[model samples]
Target: MDIREDLRDVSGQIARLLALSNVFAENNKYWAHLKNDEDFNRVYRIPEKDRYKVESIYADGRDMAIYMMDALAEINFNYARYPTLTSIIEGFQNTWVYGNYNKETPDIAKEICSTYDIDLWSVRQMFKLFKDQEKLLAAVRATLAMLQNSNLYKEENGMPTQEKHPHQINLTGINSSSININSDGASAAVNQTYNEPAVFSEIITAIKLQGLDPIIEGELIDNTHMLAAGHKSGTFKDAYIDFMQNVSAHITVFGAFLPALSALL
Candidate 1:
């Protein structure tokens, strides 16, 4: 599973949504000015021909926004196993895309509405949608940064040349202590004082319960198993920390299990 590819796809979707949002916002600007006029009611009355055109424009933008939101939601569901992506996508949906106007409106949306004198609900909603897209884009970019760093380390170290067996590490009577790992003239001492067997068991059980891909499950199991066998490396530690940060960002079903899983680091 190439996580970077998945994130790139998400980024592309958000970019498209942002462009659509900008167009929608621009279109609404004219209506906003009309709303501020003293003769707004007389000028924009339902009987006016221009009123129907404005309504049509508004409906078109609203429908497109709804369609784009649905696409994002579908992507979120498709990547449900990745807690980080799911959490970010769901946050955008809850707080911006479909949040309640009276109670759940984002602070930025409120501020923008006030600043621009935008009293229209649809315009306010567009502002919220645009802001949400921006925030989610930032999150995805940050996650990609972490993933890229890990990938670069793996490439340079030529680590995991082949998939290791879950039982590859011998765990007979190994005491808890720090181990020095050296690769290509680079070295680091990483602490390995935790109970490896117990931690490995917890990770395996959690992965199985989550029904992750067999390849992913195997990789995770082998890494944990290696750590338990006292093969602690800086690269693995960094990857472990990155995973933990992503998981901890948003509370999910895996929240309770994170602390136990993190002990492997």
Candidate 2:
């Protein structure tokens, strides 16, 4: 098998799991199916199968394989929460496309055999080789650990902080919903504009056009940017609290893994 290609495919799953872990927080929840919500309809396909089973080695009883899986699962779980793993998974998933099979043409199997020097039967075995959890999990874990320990999150640091500005505005609840203008005249008029029923983009544009400086704030969430100029803004502490409440969904998957093992056997 193309070791690198197979490794890459397994790594994709690990990254996905880490992302879920980060969001789920607790191990039990991270393994569950809470993420099966309709909002997660987006699907990512992994890289193509580059190598056949002819050169593949059995991964059973290999410590490396287990270590890899452990590492990958940790990373995948984190990404689900922090989104770092999600971005990495997206990168790997978008990098390759699987091959297509055709049977209508005469000697189709022979043609493939001639080019790849392997028959359809061997190709089937190659695919099965990847099904082994030991190898797949190990490969995933290794990739996850590499990404988790990377400098992306900053190894030694507290919570991530945004750029610190010297000047600060303490407008009392100038949120989009209820803008309380402490001043009269133009300030009140501007505050009213903020409460207008305009789209977020339009409001931002208007604020930029105005002579007074305005700021658009929100959390840079996974694969999305949220506007926090109003009541929409939230604290990470709240997010973590909410995450812990639903962490069990992710953990349930581990129990199901045993059934998968049985089926493979």
Best by lDDT: 1
lDDT of 1 at 13: 30
Listed per model in order, the count of residue pairs whose N, CA or C atoms clash below 3 Å is: 0, 35
The alpha-carbon lDDT assigned to residue 144 of candidate 1 equals 34
Provide the lowest-lDDT 10-residue window in model 2: 217-226
Regions more than 4 Å wrong, model 1: 1-117, 152-242, 245-265
TM-score of each: 0.25, 0.20
Off by more than 4 A, model 2: 1-15, 19-53, 57-67, 74-118, 122-152, 155-160, 163-265
Estimate candidate 1's alpha-carbon lDDT, on a 0 to 1 scale.
Answer: 0.39
**Per-candidate local distance difference test:** 0.39, 0.28
Give all candidate RMSDs, comma-separated: 19.2, 21.2
Tell me the tens digit of each residue's lDDT in model 2 across 195-249: 3223333433433444442221111111011111111111212222222222223
Could you give me the TM-score of model 2 versus the true structure? 0.20
Displacement of residue 204 (Cα, Å) in model 2 is: 32
